[model samples]
Target: MPVMPSSAPSVEKGPTLRNDSFSDRRDSVNKLETGCLSIIVLGASGDLAKKKTFPALFNLYRQGFLQSSGVHIFGYARTKISDDELRARIRGYLVHGKGGPPHTHSEDVSKFLQLIKYVSGSYDAEDRFRLLDKEISKHEISKNIQEGSSQRLFYLALPPLVYPTVCKMIRRFCMNKYNHGGWTRIVVEKPFGKDLESAEKLSTQLGDLFDESQLYRIDHYLGKELVQNLLVLRFANRFFLPLWNRDNIDNIQIVFREDFGTEGRGGYFDEYGIIRDIFQNHLLQVLCLVAMEKPVSLRPEHIRDEKVKVLQSVLPIKSEEVVLGQYEGYRDDPTVPDSSNTPTFATVVLRIDNERWEGVPFILKAGKALNSRKAEIRVQFKDVPGDIFRCKRQGRNEFVIRLQPSEAMYMKLTVKQPGLEMSTILSELDLSYGQRYQGVTIPEAYERLILDTIRGDQQHFVRRDELKAAWEIFTPLLHRIDDGELKPLPYKPGSRGPVEADVLLSKAGYRQTHGYVWISPSL
Candidate 1:
């Protein structure tokens, strides 16, 4: 088991601090930036900032993850909006589905909104960024923070094309190394780059300005409760440790399916398709956790090092083992080109050339406009050598980890029928989260990841080399698709993607259970 860091820093003025509040206080050696802190959203007026970024910050603020007195939120963009206008715009989103209901939390929402200040600026204009710095400095001064002790965090919620300029502006104008004794951290979102070459170039650019420790590459999926539970379910479990390898497991599937297509983001989706959008990053990150060796310690670096090894061991992808499909109505979106061949669905079989995973296929399937909306990991164990009970016909023993909608970990195993007859049937050992963890509102993925960034933990974030290894694995296939050599097969919207996808899965040794479906247990 991993142990916590011996000590942690505290805020000068605010609710008292504790190590676990920032992190497990383990693995990472970063000092908690607990004093006067400024969280600047670089693309503040944008949709991402309004929808995810601000809402997450508000949750952290009310939960005391953020220092109410010393911490401030800043919005920066070229929209030329006032602080009050930004506040009003942000207010509309803080009241949302699970943790949000306007009337119940109106007072807290208002208070949280008040902590945010907005600054308008161009991505490349040093003078405009200089104004942003001034506002940040002014807020720190007002909070009684000394000149050399101010924590500045800038979140780039903008498109990647503008990352270089925005990063340049932050490094030149707002970095704590230049203006304060406290630290400066930047959180950037993904589609880190389209391919390996571009990803490395971007990394080099960011590396020149900041140490790797100061940059947090946020992947919200990693923060999901189930995904975060992967390590515990594996390393900490006595039974799974032996059966997780190629010997007992037949095949593993990590799936992501959505009930709706791109909506109106087709213009952007057309350029990257499903592989870049879902597989390369989200599915692959999940694969790392599912396939990696247990790290020596839970330190962020140790865990990340194991993930890197898994990625590095993956063999080159073969075309015959891949299935790509474009939903019939995908191009109907006005933003999508009439002749666009962008795939809304894809299933890629990745094989890791390592002792534990050799001969086992790690199938990652993702699609938009499917029959359902859910994400899950299914691990099917091989059939027993002697089927005396005749349970093989019932189905193979499979352990499933559902990642969303209703979180769960259930095992489908053979059991005697509940009757006075001598018969066997497949039943589940269910741990449906809704029923098992009633009244527990799982924190939003963005909320948890943002907090980790504040805590300086990278165990859940992608490491630089890890990102490089991932891009290298998919770059060849991506280039082939771009060159129109590997065309996407067409499939109807709302259907299981092209039948060929299923055929590929079967050829790769995946057997679907017949006559039985596992329903999530209700609360």
Candidate 2:
């Protein structure tokens, strides 16, 4: 494991003091001159690059975060394409306004596209990377950037299989050898590896090629506004500090559901099931935030250290505690093999053995083609024990942090009915972001993460040790399911996941909210 830095500056004084200190640091860092930043989007012709990466860059450019003349964008892939063609392909996905049609082919779009240039190349070939380096250097020289003053950022939007070869190629032929007084950074997308061993191997290989500070493994969930607010909600609020653990909390559910299926894109989904795709990285990361101890400070490494400790305390998942399912029509996809037993849904209970979370079950559930589309963290607090009121079966007081479709944090509490009947009813203290932030636009996950990379903040990115520990908790169960040829139960489209999931939650003491269904505000 890499050594952590000294504790971050103390925040116990007050929010004002901490905010001022952070702002000062940020201003100083942002003012430092790092000349001619070159952002290279590998796999530029692929869906991820066009749909997410380019759109994020365009938004940053539009907002004046990226320097107009000192920054350049490069699109690289194996497909032969012209600069105009590449720009045209990604223009439609770029978001230009709120509640309005995209500004496709407009003046702003054209201007943003002007900074982008395309280059076709093979992933493993040294000559291609050398050519890429030359293209980058040409831009720097034209801008009169000094040799040792420019920075380079490479975003790998490619498949995992090509990671090693591409990283090796970039290291050998593309890295800034002129010292660049600036940095070379690579942003990697996840499913970092299929399992623990492969993840460790990949880490080792990358470790040999680049320093840990230069590598960023991204999980987009961390960039969501509500997800980021988790820290403030827990540490800054005295209300939650006393009830965050096993003492007052009964159970916690971190759920992810999609209303749509793979849409014949099972070629990739079949290899790694929903567990690897969602539970292993995204949901688990959320769990860490929900359960981790307060960090020594807000520094990235300090926060990560607490997360690592929480993950380390989790007990191995028992076989009987897991439920896996395949949505109906999954195997019917042309890209999926007939005999494939890949799971499209999975729910597993993880128990942390540490004192704070000893008895509380942290249930993680995710599925595609489910009854609803939502991602949220639900904290069910223990029922008001020894009630003096006449309501015998009152609902459990719960706090929910919604992380998608809409962003909000609300608490469910029991209160008396307004009338003189002295009746009890469940009511919510809601803080829906849509209603609260009215016309303000929330930046997408990719936008925030990309900006973080530019600013060198690792707080929202995964560290190597955290990745390894996450795999350690899940790999054994994954191997067992594969080796045993565990046939997942089948569930119909547009329905909740398999019945087994409900049973699993019930056995672990979670009851669904009786009459509540989340309706998207836009809908």
Q: What TM-score would every model get versus the actual structure?
A: 0.94, 0.92
TM-score of 2: 0.92
| Candidate 1 per-residue lDDT over residues 305-330, each given as its tens digit | 99999999999999999999999978
Tens digits of per-residue lDDT, candidate 2, 369-431, equal 999889999999887768888543656788999898788888888889899788888778888
Candidate 1 lDDT score relative to the true structure: 0.85
Best-matching candidate per lDDT: 1
In angstroms, the error of model 2 at 422 is 0.3
- TM-score: model 1 vs. ground truth: 0.94
Superposed Cα deviation of residue 305, candidate 1 (Å): 0.5
* Steric clash count of candidate 1: 2
Best by TM-score: 1
